[model samples]
Target chain A: MDWTALVLSLKLAGATTLVLLPIGVILGRVLAFHDFRGKRWVEAAITLPLVLPPTVLGYYLLIALGVASPIGQAWQALTGDTLVFSFSGLLIASVVFNLPFAIQPLQRAFEGVGQDLRHAAWVGGLSTFATFRKVELPLAWPGLLSAAVLTFTHTLGEFGVVLMVGGAIPGETRTIAVSIYDRVQAFDTAAAGIMSAFLLISAFIAIAVVYGVGARAVRLRG
Target chain B: MGWAHARCGSVAEAGPGGAGEGLAVRLRQAGPIPLSVDLACAPGQLHALVGPSGAGKTTVLKAIAGLYRPQAGHITCGPAVWFDSAAGAWLPPQDRRVGMVFQSYALFPHMSAQANVETSLAHSARTERAARALALLTQVGLADKAHRRPADLSGGEQQRVAVARALARSPGVLLLDEPFAAVDRRTRRRLQQDLAELRSSLRIPILLVTHDLDEASALADQMSVLHEGQILQTGTPEEVMRRPASERVAEILDLSPGV
Candidate 1:
């Protein structure tokens, strides 16, 4: 099968997961624990990607990172390389499209770590920061793991967004999903079939891991 | 079961090195369990706030512990001003050096019993924390289960661990918000006995909030009756039971006049 495409997909997913991990955790925690005016609006905006069509999202992202846009112009000036049709542009697109996949699990997990535990920690002479590190983080570890795995798995299978923003450039932005589509267009059904099976199995295993962690957390919470 | 001496349990008797005198509070709020309270508990005295569910009993305890801030209040604990709304002086919960046993126990499920207690020893030396935590656990009769997480412990054991953690910091004031409400009757009795025994060693005022009047009379040196967020009466449980001051106080206590 297309090994380079496979490798590129893994690398991109890995980078996206690494970047999303801290953002998801902070956003998730703030959303879970804090009350603020317009919180519902903030929550709705975060969950928008879950409902937004991928191609529609990709089209917006394409214009946002196009040569004429501010972000696109700045990137070219700073890096001397245009963002459109580049792996960096694809990575940014993947991050935006995959926000729900990274954040929802973490928010749910943080919410599960009860307010009583946090209050108890604080009254036990632990600061808010200390309580988070010592109590909330440990309790929400399963959610964090699930968030990472989901983000990685979802990014690896990203197709429309990557294709829209990065095109199908070999070795630069052609992920396994894009490669499979290219193979199918060339009538390379055998290669497409193999890659699709691999993606499907890996996605299944990733989801199974998330479910397993959630179940274990629930049992432990008992 | 022999709670005869427990009624007067160690009263701290103005004795040498008795529980330190602290915990003076006045609070006023309009909603969310609206509270109007003016109360004080001396060193070594267990003051129980007896009330119905919406009487703001837990909120009173939380206010003393610096966990909840009322619209206006002041709390003084052993020469330290924990909160003063007029002055805009509010100590965060961590700095209050207050021990609080939540109704739910609220133990860190991920930490072992010893570690849970050890978390309160943040101010103590690192190497000494384990032994100190063990000592506290042993005091609560959970020495053998130090390595077990909260999930492995029984409800009673978890509550005991929460107590041990609260005591680890040698707090200036202790707050118990229906700490025994979740356990079995037998366990609750045992926990009450444990608190009575441990009360002698603590040099801090304790504020207990409970809906159970019997529990209040059995444990509190002085009890305050709260209704609709207002502390209607404060006296020794015996005094309150015998003379409820108002018809409303008698009704709240389920006591008939002259009974």
Candidate 2:
């Protein structure tokens, strides 16, 4: 079993979780509390990336980050590099692809905490930022944890996005999911089986932690 | 007499008189029928605004707290003008420094009684915050429950902690909206006494909004009977109880003119 693939997959999932957390929180807050014209349309747009075929998202991301595209050209000029076929590109794709998995739970959690608490804090002299930080975030921890766990597991198992954007590069973009595919292609059934087992265990552990924390929050709040 | 003198001294300490000085407010919001209010609160006094639900008792408090901007009107507290339509001066809630205790108690569920009180004193030093919060909780007779979260405590305890939180900032004015409606009767009596004692000790003006006339009569030095967004009458509670301004006021006050 090549440990590097497992290690890289873990790194990618971890990084994706970290980067997506604040974005998911902000998006969840907006979706839960903010009232704006075309709010439903905006919500659908934010969540669209989730339901769209991963391969389609991957294809678009590949094109958008390819050397010929304007975004890729800008990247090339700024960092002397291209995002297409890179691990970083795979990460970006995974974050977008798994965003709703992170956002929906958080939004639901924020909604459950209700507007009354926020209104109270506002009148008590807490600023909007302070209210969110001190009251909203702490109260929504359960939802946030669940969303993060779901996103991490989803990102860890992503095949289409990684396959299309990562290009199965060894030690660079070759995650456990990609490794499993490579092993199956090379007729190495034993290695593929081992990687699959580990992936399942990791996912189970992540989900258990999420549910564990969420249940505790419910118990405390109750 | 001792308590009365102490109360008088506290009022003097609050300023020249101790209670809020000539608090007046008028609000006109945007709608087909805008909200309109005009009333004054004397110093060292508790004025109860009793009305039916949606009669805009809460709106008056929110307007005074700078939570809502009226399309037109003014609110002047003492010599300092909180909201002046002519000058376009509208102070924020923080600047107004008015303490408010909500019906839900709104004690931060994550915080213990002590911490909740401490948060009200953001500008104070950490040691002073803790000390003041502890003292306030003790004053509210919840010193033993200082470490318990709002969820862990009973409804009455949470309300007391909320009152402690409101007083932690030492605001010149206090606003309580149905503060005792959620508590049991026995607890309600204790809370009512605590509020009365607090008012007797501090000389700060209090504005209490409630649907219950009994609550209003018990807590308010002055009473303003409101219905349909209008103040029907304003006077001392005893005077209002003795003389009804109109048939409607008499009916609402649960009173009748002398036979």
Candidate 3:
């Protein structure tokens, strides 16, 4: 019933997906291709958010983006505003939390593109950038679509990190997930049930699209 | 008429002492076994590199193509120095002007046959790219199949498309790594004939890697017998067939000592 929160949640999810896609692609390509010292450490650090408790991640983000920190100080200096408890803070937190979801699938897809095709492109007189665009991107499109959808839906349902970082600013940060919790705490079970159902159905449809359409694209390519 | 005349002109310019000065590869300690190979192929010649599996045949091709950096030595194709360890000059594959046909025919699966060839003509004028791609496809007898993706093409067709795509660059050297290993005998013969015609028309140095002795004998102007990452013999097909350099070379070639 809280239309504002639903719309805000959608906006946050969209912004988070837009911000994460390119970072995910670059990180995925690096993880897929390059071999270097401490690569395992880099990989472990990237995947840490997936296994860490959401509240733990939220705790770090809160400290890191607080007015006391260097990043927060720089933001305040430039924009005359604090980063903590802001919509931008929520977007950043969601990107960090959903990174593994975006990157792992893309890494697998780039790997599936294989070195042979890249070498062939090189021998065909295509530059590295041209080859990535002409060959890797087209071949790995399904996985990229899956990554984008996963990031979007995951951010939509975000609760712990959003709750910890953004709190409950009704018009600004009270997403659908937080609104459901607020309704339940206020003993408004009817409102909570409606919001929860909406989320459940949205998640289902997003997942179905990825599986039904994305998987078919991958299969057709193979 | 313009394209055909241009093609002939390029071919004439590439003949013997022009753009077809040939490829000279002197590589050392490149792969496993401290491989050292000294080989050359002149213009208008098909030099076959015959060796058993793991004998570093593909390594030689990669070295020539600038995909593999040799520990010591140089790779010169026509007038360009692709790699020279002493000069510390190394050209990447995209800059080396070398065309390679992989054994698996590494065509872009998402691209049509024409687009696959067009990727090689990235340096060509944008207005003439499609026409040039079509001309190369026609040269390989695939003009009608230009719109077909690699998945829709047969194995022989895929190989031909790869050849056309390689030739689209007008490379100074051509490297075929087991190009016919995947097709049947009839398709293999047809592809071989097509390649022979391509060689005669292009007049560029071509180095072919094959395990089949008959294929080598039938197509190669000269054959180099390699074993354990070393060139044991280099001579005409009849010379190597009639007189292998040593017992090991003979054994590797599967030829009787008396023969």
Candidate 4:
């Protein structure tokens, strides 16, 4: 079974989830409450990953972070390492691909918190940050948990975006999904089946935790 | 009773210059209506804003609380200028030192009554927070229900918790939007009496928004009759009830032709 690939996949998903959670929360709050011109366009752009082909997103990131680009050149100059075909590149690719999975649930959770509770907290003399921490975070924990789980599972199952950006480098970017495809190409049916089953079981457990345990926790709190 | 006396003493110590200067609001327009109101409530006094459901009464309270900004106006509570459109000074709700109880009470559903009250005592020391919150809940007659969440409390109990939470900071002004609209008649009467006693103890201005004429007449020291976002009449409740400025005001008050 590709244990190296399995470990790499978990590492990538863990890193991506850790990075995406805060970004998702901040962006979700903005989307949930604040109104500004072009907000709809911004939302559409954020959600584009949910519908757009993963390779298309990967292709854009490839050009944007490639050695020829200014960002890539600056990154290379600063770190003496290129972004393309690196674990860092794969992590960014996974985050972008899983952006909607991280943000949508969080945004819904914040919206569900409603303006009344926020207003109450404000009038109660709590600062904005305090209110978000005391009231919003507690109330929106279930949705946040769901968002985190979805981001983690989605990153673990990433195939097209990682394939496009990371290019199946062994022990570095060859995630489980990529390894499964490589196993099939190599006519290694047993290895492919093992990896696929592992991914399927992980997805099921993550989803069960979110729907079964998370919902019950929220209900019990109420 | 001890809590009330303690609060009065604290208020006096906070401002020795007598009851702190009251809340004054002058707004050209607020909310969706072309609202314009120039009203004031003296310290230690309860001013009721009486109007129909959509007559901008709650909007006036929100503007004073710094929750809603008027297009052209200033709200001055005590010595602080909460909003001044021309000077571009606007204090957000958190900085305004204003406590507001919505019609629905709007308590934090997940928190117990004590936690809800403690949240308002942000300036209190962490060690003193629980005691202070408990004292305030006792003042509102909810000391026993301090550990109960809003969902578990009755409407009157929840309202008392909201009142306790609002009073936790000794706010410069208190705004109540249809405070008794949700309670039963007996509970409403008791809450009204409790509020009246509370008003006597609190030196800061109190603004009560309600559509019920009886509520305004019973509790308010000064009453303003609003119609279509305009103050149609402003006077003592008895004066307003006895002799409305116009037929419209009388009709809105539901006063009989002779009375």
Candidate 3 residues B146-205, lDDT tens each? 999998999999999999988888899899999998999899999988887778887788
Ranking by lDDT: 1, 3, 4, 2
lDDT of 1: 0.87
Name the lDDT value of residue A140 in candidate 3.
87
Task: List ranges where model 2 is wrong by over 4 Å.
Answer: A122-133, B1-22, B226-259
Sorted into a CAPRI-style docking class, model 4 comes out as medium
The CAPRI category of model 1 is medium
Report the C-alpha lDDT of model 2 over B89-164, residue by residue, as the tens digit. 8887767777889888777778777888876787577668888888988999998999999888999989989898
> Model 4 chain A: which ten-residue window has the lowest total lDDT?
A213-222
TM-score for chain A, prediction 4: 0.96
DockQ (Cα-based) for each candidate: 0.72, 0.36, 0.63, 0.53
TM-score of chain B of 1: 0.89
Candidate 1 chain B, poorest ten consecutive residues by summed lDDT: B11-20
Model 3, position B175: C-alpha lDDT score: 93
Per-residue lDDT over A5-86 for candidate 4, one digit per residue giving the tens place of the 0 to 100 score? 9999989989999999999999999999899999999889889999988889889989988999998899899999989899
**Model 1 lDDT at residue A28:** 96
Task: For candidate 2, give the DockQ.
Answer: 0.36
DockQ category of candidate 3: medium
Model 2: which docking level applies?
acceptable
Error of 4 at A166 (Å): 1.5
Give candidate 3 regions above 4 Å deviation.
B1-20, B30-33, B255-259
* Predicted structure with the largest DockQ when compared to the true one: 1
